[model samples]
Target: MNRPTTLREAIEAADSILIGAGAGLSAADGDHHSGPVFDARFADFRDQRGITDAYSGGFYPFPTSEERWAFWSRMISLLRYEAGPGQVYADLLGLVSERDYFIITTNVDHRFQTSGFDKEHLFYTQGDYGLLQCSVPCHDATYDNEKWVRQAVASQEGMRIPSELIPQCPRCGEEMTTNLRVDARFVQDAGWAAAAGRYEDFLERTCVDRVLYLELGVGMNTPSIIKFPFWRRVYDNPEATYACVALDASAPAEIADRSLLIRGDIAEALASARG
Candidate 1:
């Protein structure tokens, strides 16, 4: 059988699926952090400060908190709030929507949830773009930032947000930052902990069965969170199958016997598999 059909059959036959996603999957959906999209949206920053992409801009040292929030607010609105469902994510959901499936993604874009995947069935190990927490993380709490982001995007002037619109930690009056896991200060609030628990419970229950550890677009930036564990699970469980789909996909020689590697566009592979 062909590769796509092989993948489809594996998905159909597996008792459960654990999906590990990374940036490539989102990129296939046109959610790019750099390139033409970034150039167009952040032209001012690029021309004035050599800040080219959203990722770099996040780390840029703006002169003041107002300017910093301005950059972040624009990024949050563009990537988090305004972004729409991706067809690749929808295709993935369709492939295993009826099966016992759970997602563990390092992606912070919230694409899976917006694409109609069950929120409870997902573990976003990295923090989300739609959330804010204390910069010092004085407390373990995350606040939703949709309203603030929208307002900031609408009201900002000359690459600066009004000082009043900058988010402040409710508990300690310190500056608030995106809930993304840039450092040790990233908060793991009640919701994050609950999702982590669910992921662990799912792993405990499914690792023993005919599980398909389907990894997509994952890279080497942070392997421990999803890639390494998925490899270990498949190695330990004889009934498990490991599949990876990416533009440059490969498998460790140890798991090669039970692994399926699809090296190509993630969206195309998903579409062909679904067919």
Candidate 2:
């Protein structure tokens, strides 16, 4: 059978579906880390600091904390708060909504939840954009950051936010940081632990069944977490079908016969599969 036909049949026959998503999925939704959108949203930062992309801008050493918060607040607002879930995610939901499905994603944008995926069936291994934690990490806890981010985006002027608006850790009065997993200090609170447990339970219950391992836009940045594991499971379970839709997806020679790798835009590939 042809690849797309094979993939459709696999999905139709599987007992459950497990989705692994990466940064490319978000890129397909127009939240690319670089290019015209980056330039347009952060032209001032690019001209002043020579920081070209959102990823690099996070590390730029602004002279003051106020200036740093100014940069981050706007970035967070644009990427997370203001940018609602896009069509790609909605199309993905349409494809899997009828099936027993679980999602584990490295994307921190909260797109899965925003797109109406059940929270109990979703696990975000990385932290989220809508949260803040103590920089020194006095404790394993996270605070909702929407109000502060909105304030910063509105009150910032001339590359600096109001000094008084800078977030402080309530426990120790230290500076606050985004809940992104930049280092070992990232907080994984009770909610994070619960989600991780749920993902583990889902895998345990479904891995031995006729599962469809659907990976989307996964790259090698953190292969151990999703990519490598998916390949290993498919190799171990003959009944499991491995399928990937990405701009740079490939199956290893060992699993080539049992895998379907579609190299194309993620949104288009999903739409075709849903059809």
The numbered model that scores best in TM-score is: 1
- Cα lDDT, all candidates: 0.89, 0.88
Instruction: Put down candidate 2 lDDT per residue, 199-224, tens digits, no spaces.
Output: 99988998788888999989998999
Error of 2 at 165 (Å): 1.3
| Reference-based TM-score of each model | 0.96, 0.95
Clashes of 1: 0
Candidates in order: C-alpha RMSD to true structure: 1.9, 1.8
In the range 57-171, model 1's lDDT, one tens digit per residue, is 9889899988888888888888887778778988998899998999999999999989999999999999999999999979999999999998998889988899899899898
Candidate 1: worst 10 consecutive residues by lDDT? 1-10
